[model samples]
Target: MKIGDTYFSADVETDGPIPGPYSMLSFALVYAGQYDGQTFEKPSKYDQIFYREIKPISENYEVEALNINQLDRERLQREGASPKDAMNDAWDWVMSLAGETKPVLAAYPVSFDWTWLYWYFIAFSDKGSPFGYSRCFDIKTAVSIKANLPFSSAGRSKLPDWLQPEREHTHFAVDDAIEQAEIFAKIAEWKA
Candidate 1:
């Protein structure tokens, strides 16, 4: 097995743009693959994953954002994992998977997803972020660099057919994580 940073494709559905005021309703991370300096090893499938739903910290939330993911706030309040517990579980899972290699957070457009996750990890876990700070890869940036296109033109619709994932981009975190993992893997192969 190649040893280096393992690319974990992460997706998050939030109650709003930020974390403290809003909340991360749910999130997922799929083992996309890894690349040594010489070559890439793609996961057989993006099935190795972790997911968790969190209880909302604040009642304040955007109704439109809540509707997007269809997460029941009341149900989450009653049954969802506490934010600290959820973040601890995620940190433990990621560390277990990483054993030897470092785990790097990968996302389509990393800004939004990374912001929420990093905030949650720090706010909830005394152990600190499993990813630390700045260990993230943006797939959109990868595509932009690989295709030699302007960053603004790196949207999904602008992706080359070879780099597109077959799965749909449903708002559900796990589903989208898997979908984004496929894209990440393809990008790695091409870039290799």
Candidate 2:
């Protein structure tokens, strides 16, 4: 039996602007909730999460980008999980959570986070991307269209106070993912 789409709110902290040249320092996926076409069942607690910090794939990294997330590259280099292990574990986690439901990735912007995640999943995991190639929901775009605001005005800072998540926007991937999940839930239930 096919169930509703299971949304996973994702966040990635990277050492550079894009994947390939830079490395994804860490990433997190929070089981946002499930939508059964008629209603979105928002989870009471954003506790089910998959998080991983992986070793850099390349030596190239920007100091400024690294400073944003404050992930110690040297420490990660020594202790972080290998990309293959992390990605595979991520795939398993997503599948386990989703079960019969179609897994859908949700993110604030989606583009940046999806890009890194897709690249890493494809390059490392044998099972490949759990969300496939394009099953993603962009909270920014949803706010823009749903709220009848210009795309430029849909940034988190510019969004209506009601739509804002109570959680702080810490640079940590898991924290950010939970925050984004809350925002997505609000947007999904919003009438406008």
Candidate 3:
């Protein structure tokens, strides 16, 4: 990879609360833009995007989770892409957009998304994880720090009007990803 770093806003919809035991139904990545270790910039339009729906690895799932993502489990079983293929394609797209810059995965709550993503990448892709083990950004933590609020208060409702996006946070992977990407940029560029 390159010497610099790029921030990739990522989101995933899963059938359950955890990886291994659950299945990731869909995932999306939005290359918000590069962060030169000091400054942040928004991408021009919808420049970088990656999205996929994967076949379930297990029969187990939660109805609430499915409802949240608005995905049809039966349809996914019949038409979803292979996990290995999807992960490979995702890695390729991330790499192409990153160029020489190291890709840094960012999520609203990194723990949940990172768990599924890292596990899937390692479990399915021979290329291993594109973001490696340590490169990750947590929007919640960043916003909490920037806003000088306690971590528990960093939820969306606590954010100021300027930081929150107007888009509805529909659980569709790509739409939520784009929404989170905007929030990430705002916090990253925030002076306070």
TM-scores of all predicted structures: 0.96, 0.98, 0.96
* Candidate 2, poorest ten consecutive residues by summed lDDT: 1-10
Point out where model 1 deviates above 4 Å. Answer: 1-3
Q: How would you encode candidate 1's per-residue C-alpha lDDT over 125-187 as one tens digit per residue? A: 867788989899999999988889999999987887887789888899999999899988888
> RMSD (Cα, Å) of candidate 2?
0.9
Taking every candidate in turn, the Cα RMSD to the unseen true structure, in Å, is 1.5, 0.9, 1.6
Per-residue lDDT of 68-182 in model 3, one digit per residue for the tens?
8889889999999999999999889888988888999999888888999999999998688899987899999998888888999998767888898858788888888888888
lDDT of 3 at 17: 94
Task: Order the candidate numbers by lDDT, best to worst.
Answer: 2, 1, 3
Q: Could you tell me the TM-score of candidate 1?
A: 0.96
Better of 2 and 3 by lDDT: 2
For each candidate, the alpha-carbon lDDT, in order, equals 0.89, 0.95, 0.88
Cα miss at 35, model 1 (Å)? Answer: 1.6
| Candidate 1 residue pairs that clash | none
User: Which candidate number has the best lDDT?
Assistant: 2
